[model samples]
Target: MITQKAKYALRALTALADADADEPVMISDIAAQQKIPKKFLEQILLDLKHHGIVVSRRGKQGGYLLLKPAHTITFGEILRIVDGPIAPLPCLSITAYRRCDDCDGEQNCQIRHVFAKVADATRKVLFSTTIADAAQPTHSAEVTRLLA
Candidate 1:
């Protein structure tokens, strides 16, 4: 399962996506609107800014905005940024692959085989779905179909 931090990051990104493209959103506004804690959101946004996913403004009218288009930012990208690898098992992770300590060989590991398929399917959906998609009202049906 994705961590709460990941969930909050997704929600925050969607909120940003829903805002005016040229306008910046204050952290307090996002925290209140999305029900995320202000302190936690500050940390999350700082991380996102460091990753180049978002950019911040300064001064009176200053705030935060997406550095890239919402459609170009995939859910998988955010999850990987906030939660690390998306795989269910270390052996199945594409970005952070490591052999299981107890496993003798990947070729003969039944668990790895099953989870590899799961990881592939999960990656397909997550990488294909974007922050813009999540902001849409009809995205649920499309996401469900992708999983199906």
Candidate 2:
């Protein structure tokens, strides 16, 4: 399962995507609109800024905005940035692979075999879906159809 931080990050990004194309959104506005805590949002936005996913502006009209187009920012990218590897098991991780301590060999590990498929399917959906998609009103219906 994705962490709360990851969820918040996605919600925050979706809010940004829904905003005016050239306008930066204030953290307080996002926090209130998305029901995320202001302090936690500050930290999340800072992390996103470091990852180059977002940029912050300064001054009376300053806040935050997506550095790249919303469509270019995938859900998988945000999850990885906020929650680290997307793999269910470390052995299945593409970016941070590590053998399970109790596993003798990956070739014979049934758990790894099953989780590999899970990881692959999860990655496919996450990487294909973007902040632009999530910001749409029909997103939930599309997701339901995909899951069904």
Over the stretch 20-78, how does candidate 2's per-residue lDDT look in tens digits? 97998999999999999999999999999999999999999999999999989999999
Off by over 4 Å in 1: none
* Tens-place lDDT digits, model 1, residues 1-148: 9999999999999999999989999999999999999999999999999999999999788899999998899999999999999999998888999888899999999988998899988999999999988887678688668768
What are the lDDT scores of the predictions, listed in order? 0.93, 0.93
Residue ranges of candidate 2 with Cα displaced over 4 Å: 138-140
What TM-score, over all chains together, does every model reach?
A: 0.96, 0.96
Residue 135 of model 2: what lDDT?
93
On the 0 to 100 scale, the lDDT of residue 139 in model 2 is: 80
Q: Evaluate residue 37 in candidate 1 and report its C-alpha lDDT on the 0 to 100 scale.
A: 99
